[model samples]
Target chain A: MSRTANGRGGHGRTGGTARRGTGAPEAGETAAELGEFGVIDRLTGERFQPEQTLLGPGDDAAVVAAPDGRVVATVDTLVQGVHFRLDWSAPEQVGRKAVAANLADIGAMGAVPTALLLSLACPGDTSTEVLDGLAAGVWDAAADAGIGVVGGDTVSADTLVVSITALGDLEGRAAVTRSGARPGDVVAVCGQLGWSAAGMAVLRRGFRSPVAMVAAHRTPRPPWRAGPVAARAGATSMIDTSDGLLADLGHVAAASRVHVDLSSRLVPVADKLRDVASALGGDALGWALTGGEDHALVATFPSEDVVPADWVVCGEVRAGTGVTVDADRWGGSGDPGYLHWR
Target chain B: MSRTANGRGGHGRTGGTARRGTGAPEAGETAAELGEFGVIDRLTGERFQPEQTLLGPGDDAAVVAAPDGRVVATVDTLVQGVHFRLDWSAPEQVGRKAVAANLADIGAMGAVPTALLLSLACPGDTSTEVLDGLAAGVWDAAADAGIGVVGGDTVSADTLVVSITALGDLEGRAAVTRSGARPGDVVAVCGQLGWSAAGMAVLRRGFRSPVAMVAAHRTPRPPWRAGPVAARAGATSMIDTSDGLLADLGHVAAASRVHVDLSSRLVPVADKLRDVASALGGDALGWALTGGEDHALVATFPSEDVVPADWVVCGEVRAGTGVTVDADRWGGSGDPGYLHWR
Candidate 1:
């Protein structure tokens, strides 16, 4: 899952100082004052490493167990003012979002995460509180995935950029790539769809009371386990909804050389999302169909019976190309999905 | 190995437009004009994937063979103004430098590299020609290492950032970590030492001739095979010289809780380096001791007999703390080692 700017806030958002469980960093000591090693020590020291970590930090490189004889690897980068803002979200939240993006990509391949490597480049004057919060958030999210950060590099840059590489073990299973779907397969999805986009919309409108929506925007909890579950249930293809449901499904469609037609009524849109859409004079269904960054797992199963209980069947794959809703092109209000640098 | 300012030009250095083997991009099309997937296709399409790569690009994640049941991983980032100036070095050279840095770290662990993941973030106005040069350079370097570009993410940012993650296989050997040097071990190094520093000095003085020196500063060729050779020869600890000789050895000293005392006469300072230093009026020995980014492999062996023939013995691990030259602290003209943001 790649970080993309939602249509609402097209960059340039700031927020308050971040506070994390690890406590604020050394009374506002900036990264420059702490120096590189000091910052590294503060971030990596005392963190729990899982069994997969044969070697952790304080070395030239880290060794991780790839028990299945194969490793799944992916990388994603988040740049401040481009993918996130210090004012809109806490440093910890940004950290979680970074990890979530890469982990979700690993999950999309039907692999269980093993280790993560973080390379952070930020202005020297960045407060330790923000750095600590970012590290704390990364550690917390990594813990949730049962993985640990192995090795990383820290450097100085004019901008704050967080790049993460997530490694995963496939558990001896064939990877569920986007090209595996067939014309007869059934399309399904697991986890939240438009909550992040809705949250971003609320945040753009200057209303913080819909805290749940805003939090979802800040830290998306991708359905990490659903990927492997779908793979085990004989999924034909899978991808995460980083670029909205229709847009992500389009990738599967193009790669699988098949057409996807979703039943408009079957595509789940939450009641809470509808309420927010109405209050903001927005389209909840439109957001659910086209907004990105929710990181929901969408996959295609050979038949309805093979679709797992956790996945909601939303569409059918047919012989053709492109994606459609109710047998026609999606007449959504916004673009099907937004790509960076466009 | 991390990128550190060499203390000469500080940061502001610029050069000419990049031209690489793949040919310049179509009429200087900017990345924004091509969009994200288009850029991905251009950078990744038709690239070679070595046998270790089970799945290459155009996927949620790439699957790589980890024949040794474990994977060695490391990450490094190079920022445009911070690590390299596009005007001084071509995009291809910057790409090669980024890969070289991470691969050197993997080699320091006594592992054979298997694959690489690149996360590139640059301004929307960056020309596709530069992007193509970077990709070509990355592919060329990966080819030399017998690996492939497995997966990556491309995004738009205010500055150009190239972050790479390299993975390696240990081939059943124990990883040579930083904390394993013994008190009686002899320190040896393989590959160029002060050439990069001299090259940087030459560039800072606005003289680009002495082509070899400037090239060395642009692209370091780490002795990748020497790492495994040292491991087989019973080397106890290893590190790459990203922060010069004395500074990197200090890491080994602190990690192993041993003192490292170098014999000044035994250290190999190349004749060409002396020639460059003479012309530039710079101290070659000082540059060799304190200048960084050469990425040479330095290791500790039980004794001279077990040291590989290709390595030159320059120092000994002693029963004390801190690094010294001829049993005394180095009186180098500059900092013992430079750290980013210091």
Candidate 2:
């Protein structure tokens, strides 16, 4: 079961028309005109791979180094209309978001991301500018994670779909899973919460003010490294907050068979989010608790002393089931989180 | 470039309705009603993973053992109406085809496939029966390859897309890349050629009399093991005939900066294919030379004697350029294989 984040509210672009130029495909050149091989060459022709890439693209398959004798793997897909709109998010931003989702999963397992494989399905008439931007974004995010796109496939379809597979190495350490939390563990979080949801809210209302919020929605900068840090600090269990804090925490609780008790006051609600919420007549606490797609790292530690300094202790694991706020079930503005196909 | 096999004329099936009784979905159940988690559970819950899957599904990511410290990774995408039609090929057949595509790439690299990651995107209204068949097909192929699907992601999309990533092990041997063919290498093939194209031709003409040809189109039996055998026998270069024999060999010739000359008389053409060609007024030899999607292992060896007993020697590599048939460029019916987005 590869972890999938659902119900992302996509808005904006109708097609891959190149707007801002930075190594984008030349105007008027479509993927069909370039042909499959041409498009593939444009996507993967020039790239510097790490030492972990024993044999990169241009082969039947790429050879990646999995030095620890084990490889951590995950797959994530981003549909054009369902995940992001071209008008709202740049092709590069969409590319970054796609890679970020899988890298965050790798980090949640307390492993170092190694390589990425991309499978892109789009209409034949898709513009080269969009392809270039998407490629740039993918390579940029991969570079940020210290890896590269070793291999990929490109095919034609009715809609644009970007599916990415990420590989990671555990470095001889045990993988921290979601099923290991105990009754006496401490619940902590590192990285932004509710920012992406708030950003989405801002975008949904037809307002683009508060540039930071909209940017967060377009590109989530997950604290991926914090996952390994927590694991090294003896984290009992961990997960990435992709499906909102409460919803994701519920996954950990269900897997670990432990109850999570959250103190609303202890859960940090950023002043910026509060300001945006007040302006929009929204509930900041509800957003923090239930809004998803921030890609934050939430974890459980045996004790407060073992918790990393950067992680904010907001809850505790107890002898019960499900999650609670102020010792009671959460009755908030939103449901636990968005469910796909609902 | 990920070596995409283009131009498979798809036929049949409108949606995923349970036509078969073997582990099919309950009557009229849909993925939307089951929700995302339910769909995931059904897809991954009941599978038995191989020893290479150190940690199976349910976590943020899966851990697969890579005993050789290296993993051969490749990704391939199969789009509805492009690669397969549900009516023409069962959902199980589609799943098998998707996984088989990647496994062939792994084999072409002289590696043994170890694990698979699947990403499925379809409408919420997709039938549970279709999904079940798809999962069954995927697992069956994996079992045959001595591996399992360790991780995957499923999301909602207008068009159904099956994207698979296959990981393989080199077992401490040097990867036989495409750029290693020498001037005196002998070109040999170890699997059926043009069979899939012939099957597609039969289907296109509304004649399915030859069940064997249609079955070949539905589920190709790639000679994946022959890759490592050829490598052990000291193959100089190798590739899968996904994009037809001549086109694929052209890739080798370009990458290795050598010339490949195929002797027309030596190329194998089965009598059944000849009969079918006679009925359809199609050239069997032309199909054998340029038809794609057979997943045949075509490689170059140091000499004809060095080629394995199972392989059929058909050509030789020279110190010049491109691919030539009978000492001249091919003047065949089809373009040197099909081109995607053309």
Per-residue CA lDDT of model 1 for A1-342, tens digit only, reads: 000000001111112123233664464388899877766666665567788888877788888999999999888888898788888999999999999988888888888999998888888998888888899889889989998877687888899999888999899999988888898899999998898889989988888847788888899989978898888999988888888888788877877788999998999999988999999998998988887888889999999998988799999999999999999998877446666776
Give per-residue CA lDDT, model 1, range B1-342, as digits (tens). Answer: 000000001111112123234754553388888777667666666567777888777777888999999999888889888889999999999989999988888888899999998888888898887888898888889989988877787877889999888999999999988778898999999988888888888999999969888999999888987899899898998988888888788888887889999998888888888898889888888888877888889999999999998899999998989899989888866445556676
Error of 1 at A216 (Å): 1.2
Q: Give the Cα-based TM-score of candidate 1 against the true structure.
A: 0.93
Model 2 segments more than 4 A misplaced: A1-21, A24-28, B1-28
> What is the lDDT for B87 in model 2?
80
TM-score of chain A in every predicted structure: 0.92, 0.92
lDDT by residue for model 2 (A1-342), tens = 000010000101112322233554543488899877766766666566777878777778888899999998888889988888998899999999988888788888899999998888879898988888898898889988889788788888899999888999998889988888899898999988888889889999999978888888888888988888888999988888778888788888887888999999999899999999999998899989987878888999999999988899999999878999988999978546555577
Regions more than 4 Å wrong, model 1: A1-28, B1-28
TM-score of chain B of 2: 0.92
Predictions' DockQ, in order? 0.39, 0.39
Interface RMSD of each: 11.9, 11.0
Docking class of 2: acceptable
